[model samples]
Target: MAAVTRGSFSVLRQLLSQQYRRRCFRLQNFRSDRTLQPLIFRCDRNLQMFGSRALHTAIVSQGPIVQFKLSDIGEGIMEVTVKEWYVKEGDKVSQFDSICEVQSDKASVTITSRYDGVIKKLYYDVDATALVGKPLVDIETESSSEVIQEEDVVETPAMAREEHTHQEIKGHKTQATPAVRRLAMENNIKLSEVVGTGKDGRILKEDILNYLARQTGAILPPTPFQEIQTPGPAPAPAAAAAATARPVSTPATKPPPTTPKPVFIGKDITEPLKGFSKAMVKTMTAALKIPHFGYCDEVDLSRLVAVRAELRSVAEARGVKLSYMPFFIKAASLGLLQFPILNASVDEGCQNITYKASHNIGLAMDTSQGLLVPNVKNVQLLSVMEIAQELNRLQALGAAGQLGTGELSGGTFTLSNIGSIGGTYTKPVILPPEVAIGALGKIQILPRFDANDQVVRAHIMNVSWSADHRIIDGATMCRFSNLWKEYLENPASMMLDLK
Candidate 1:
């Protein structure tokens, strides 16, 4: 009887295994069409499916939150060490709230949250290196009907555990663009509950402006200016009304003039060098190491000025304004074509002078942060309008302190426009790895003798060239300067093959 029972159990298990195999075989057959497709396509689809699952799992487990990995911070910043945490775990953070501080070799920046949620977890400790694009924290969202906490509450580490709880929160939120995220971080603006009015519920620039306007009391009218409108004394409360009552017969008397006293103060004050200030220091230091030779020349800009005015009108018609820098750039390019040696740089270690084929002009822009010289890549090939556009973009980026690392590098020549700063003439320092720098001073109408020996008041501008003495000789520098002046003064000569 025992042998019969064991045999019956074994037969039942075998029949169940057969049915399971049949079902698996049918499933495999149904998926055979997908398997027969290109292996690359199949792999890509599989990856997409896996990514979707991972994203879903992360969102569900972590709550309605997205972690901007360090990779999203910027290009080439693969990893960064955490300097500090502005917002602690479990802290209720709005979108664009500075959550943490990070340090890279290039710069120190604050990392902000991308969504409105409670910070549930911090993956990195202080000074821990977190790679770009790696999850740094988890955030749990709050419900719509839940009363928002008014008081600022500090978050604790214990809240990390609650991140795993599978609870759904009501209310949908908009995601911010990378540009908007940067703007908010720089401006200290809170994006959550800001009411986005963009398409698909996106936050536009106007929304940020509106938020700022509201914060600054834009709805209120401006206070009227009055010569004697100073703040009055505070009103006494009802309890002290009898005691505060004073005689109204006498006219209001002015307080006795106080003697001025000098306050001597001593304290340790440290000014942090950042942005363009830091960049300027680095550039100047590098330039000091190079052996420099200075060259100066005055260019007759009468023709150039007229041409610029004509071009300005044309540009206005085309909806593109032109600046004097483009004319200088073109003239410098022409001069470089004639005298390539001026554009060459000597490598002391390599014991060779390298001449660059491409003419990349670096424009010196004075920003509020500091002096910045961002380069225009391949300026020789671009038209005058293109050069103007590029210059405008570089100036805009420099002013905003948003210039990329590579945009600051790889320059064949540098142009400093001191003319904008009310200088008639000035010498500019040569940026290293580049042989020469050209300075454009203020243009003015001056009396001068022409080639025909008649005195005339002509629009003139001074061009000062600073070159590396080791690479460029005085004669070659003078030739380059003269060629540049000739191109500018003639204006039409730039369009011809003067080389």
Candidate 2:
């Protein structure tokens, strides 16, 4: 009976195995017919180890290769018309080596290599637009070579090329700050060569200095022109002798009172305004549209002068030189704090007055490019030493004509120091967006009565304030001016509050 029962169980197991095989075969046939939904086999592992490994390998092999996309190239510099190629395919290059000469908007640029590599392929034909950031050529680096597949050709799309071309003509060229481009042009240096030392590697003055130093002996100086002498024809014999004997005397009738003819030339040649000149015109026009009011005041800086000298002595011991600017900046900051409205800007379009919490003071720097105001960001938060350092930096950059767009823009208030130019007093124009500007004049010794009614010589400075009348009333403006004057008269107050 036991043998019979075991035989029945074995038969039942074989029948079950046969049914399972038939089901799998039917599923396969359905999948092959493409008439049934495919089954997704769920993996036992929670994490996809194979996919993770593939991604890790991809990341590792791609290495440091920066495929210049259309964006990497500057705006308005989208498609560069390739003028010349400096290297052939497979040529090895170092960072900053001139790669090609490309023309855009009548100007030509020698684009440089941003990384060290071997040229694998040239993407465009000569005279073609190499859109900014679009790979002009493929670079075969060790790491890139590992990840480079047969299908990974540097493909630039037609739309991308067109976009690059449009950007080159419209945006990039217009957005470049005048100071930076002027420096590049004056030195006959390429903008790409000047590694921006400012925020985000935006080129600054110090970068220009370094570039100039490197290129010093590479460029030849202009040679002076030599004088040329031309021979005159021999004089007629008898007639010339008579003319010479006449003493060439004009009856001193003032030679008929010779009136110079009003010379009318042809059409005057005109160049399209560009760079700082264009920017200045735009800023001034915008500022003039705003309603403005001017207020002038005189401050006795005698006590401040004494305090500055003492502070300078202390600064010298600490290996940092102190300038009058820091004292003035601190004083101005204090005054702004006392009357926050002075640091406010009026949005006439929105009909709103906006008060700023942090004082980002703009310093009007006279650069070769023209008057540029690069702000010292968060001036209120920095110490006097820090302010002096930033002021020095801004001045140095201004002189080198290396200020960036970011530096050139954004300021809650502006300070124009005409004192350096020996000006006693002058009303400065308000920098737009910011409602007010202050001008510092030369400090001079003038006789004035003290609190005790004793007349004595005091070092005094003229303070000129200009504000947008639409934002501030005359009384409020006077109050702001008075606050500044009080701070300058007692600089000790600045030290205490700033500290």
Candidate 3:
């Protein structure tokens, strides 16, 4: 009787399997028809189905949130600092709108929005470091098809402040750029108390400065002069305001008897170096490892000065401001032709030396940002006039802080004119990858004995050199220096090597 009962259960299971197979075959046939497509739809309450098949539905509908990551800005930069943000959380932005600016080791670059959306979150604040390929901001895109439910989206600190920021915007809260806010923070001034004269009631840097001037009763020049008709102690506030009112000058008086003010112990403020300054720190550290051969000498520049003066008018007519830099650079390139080792770089193992074919001579510029050495490409092939033109172009870009990485790298040699800023001599440190660096001192008119032993005034300039001792000996460095000096002393000699 037990065997018969087991056989009956087995037969029932077999029949059920056959029935399920038949149903699946029918579904497959239904799917094959082009007109009859698989349909996903809500069934009765608490159920969803695709055709006749039940599906586990856990779909959460929300607008597409894009995490905008910091991208590589070229020149092998791995990271950047968040310099400024043009938009904050909850602000609406269009595609291609400049949302933020970042400072890399090379230069400052403004990043644009890739989507038309509302700024949902900012992952970084001003002056914060951001790595390439990491999210910088989150944006809720407008073009997303999915309908976003408020409860479905996660609320973050940045998003929580969005409503508050919106309310502030409606109430005409103080609007200022990041730069203006930084200035206020440095001076310990409150932007709320300072009146804004900028468009749409925005606080500017000038406003902060003016406010400080008024409080201190110091007449700051360039403060907008306004006539205050009301005169009294009551109207003093207006008169002291640097923006709206002119500062009132009072007669000087002796200080009252009181305890002497404590000697100022300078406050220590720490800040991470960014952009070119940061690059300099790393480059210089590596440069110190190279054993340097130092050399210094003087060259008579009387003929060079006269030659420059003669060409100045011609250069001005061509819209180029000619300077001693072009001649110095040109002469260096000419000297390199004779002494190629000066333009060569040694390998890390110090087993091989590379003599570069092109004389890409770098010029050290002292900019407001930091020391920048931008090279003129193929100086060996460029004429003095051409070099001068390139020099002007580079100087302009450097001054405006818009120089590119290509303009700053790939140098076979470097030249620094410390004389322009009032230096007699400087032992310039060599920039690696290529070996030698030269520094020129200020031109001085000193009396020197001529061939006839009579003292005469002559234009003299001092030059200091630093070379890789592993590759360049003192004798070779001196010989190279002499050749360069000879070219400068006789300005006409450089013309022979001009392309």
What is residue 241's positional error in candidate 1, in angstroms? 62
Clashes of each: 5, 11, 0
TM-score each candidate. 0.56, 0.54, 0.63
The most accurate candidate by TM-score is 3
Error of 3 at 134 (Å): 1.3
For residue 173, give model 1's deviation from the true position in Å: 20
Candidate 1 lDDT over 12-65, as tens digits, reads 999999999999999888896875667656567778899999998876755444
Tell me the tens digit of each residue's lDDT in model 2 across 135-194: 677765554443344113332343332222112221012112458567667877555324
The digit string of per-residue lDDT tens for model 3 on 376-495 reads: 988887777777766776776676665555577788999888887788887789998879999988888888988899998788889999999887899998998998899998877776
Off by more than 4 A, model 1: 1-69, 72-117, 120-266, 271-275, 346-350
Question: Deviation in angstroms for 188 in model 1?
Answer: 34
Q: What is the full ranking by TM-score, best candidate first?
A: 3, 1, 2
Candidate 2: segments with Cα more than 4 A from true spot: 1-93, 96-112, 117-269, 451-455
**What's the lDDT of the predicted structure labeled candidate 2?**
0.65
Which has the better TM-score: candidate 2, or candidate 3? 3
